[model samples]
Target: MSSSNSVEGSYSKRCAACKHLRRRCAEDCVLAPYFPATHPERFECVHKIFGAGNVARMLKAIPVQERAQAADSLSAEAYWRVQDPVYGSTGIVIQTNQEISSTQCELAKIRAQISMYEAQMATEQQPPPPGLPQQQGSLGSQENMPMFEPNDPFNFLN
Candidate 1:
């Protein structure tokens, strides 16, 4: 029964590239796991943008641990290429830079406004000039009185 089961065991389906190429998928095929048959469109886009040979070469050039990341990058690049044939990812980068510049300009404007407000507050909080006499009494008799010292705790008049 085990022998029969082993004999009847199904072989894993070929990856997108192998299926598209009508070639046998080896056990250690590099593109198999990344380009599974479930997401054929992803592989199709990647394959269309970067040819199968180029994809295989890229995957082979990178270390095994980095292959998945490389595949993801390739897929994103392929998608962007389909969206913008002329500029692709460069268009995205440019748009992002413009957004950053706009945000920085807004931030600078806000900072300048804040600085102006702070300056106004500082001026508002300052004491009037010494030469400018404030009203001391209704009859103006106390106008000529000596300035009170806030730091003197003992009242000499008392």
Candidate 2:
């Protein structure tokens, strides 16, 4: 009917949820703003993972102000589910945490090695103990003794 067509034309062509559900999108559809028709796949993925009924129930159960955020979370979860069927986003998070821990351990080892090298260098540059004199020659050698003339006039014993 012309009136029906006009009424339908008055609203958006189709919201993502309506397209995924294969139904007409009403003007006041709650999901229209969050899931526009331009990105139907967003709703499709979410619907496939969390059934349409569950999504509707969840949206209805939460506060109206929080629905958009919830829809975003659902879409992200669905995408992760498709990417990693076994572990999803959780696996990626775990793997990232493990890498961070490993890097931290490696950094600690490098710091300890640097400290050891610094200690070794410091010891090498330090002067020896004060009281230990350097050995130049034997103590009993007469080569360094002062020579005395036997006929010196200044000799008091003569």
Question: Highest lDDT, which number?
Answer: 1
Candidate 2 shows a clash count of: 0
Q: Mind giving the per-residue lDDT tens digits that candidate 2 earns over 1-158?
A: 99988867854577888877778887677777778889988888888888877887888889999998998998999888888988988988999999999999999999999999999999999998899976667675577776667788776666
TM-score, each model?
0.66, 0.72
lDDT of each: 0.86, 0.85
Worst 10 residues of 2 by lDDT: 133-142
Candidate 2 off by > 4 Å:
1-12, 133-158
> What digit string (tens of lDDT, one per residue) describes model 1 on residues 1-158?
98766534423377887777777777789999799877888888898899999999999999999999999999999999988999999999999999999999999999999999999999999999899887656667765777767667675753
Which candidate should be chosen as best, given TM-score against the real structure?
Answer: 2
Q: In angstroms, how far off is 13's CA in candidate 2?
A: 3.2
Candidate 1 displacement at residue 157 in angstroms: 56
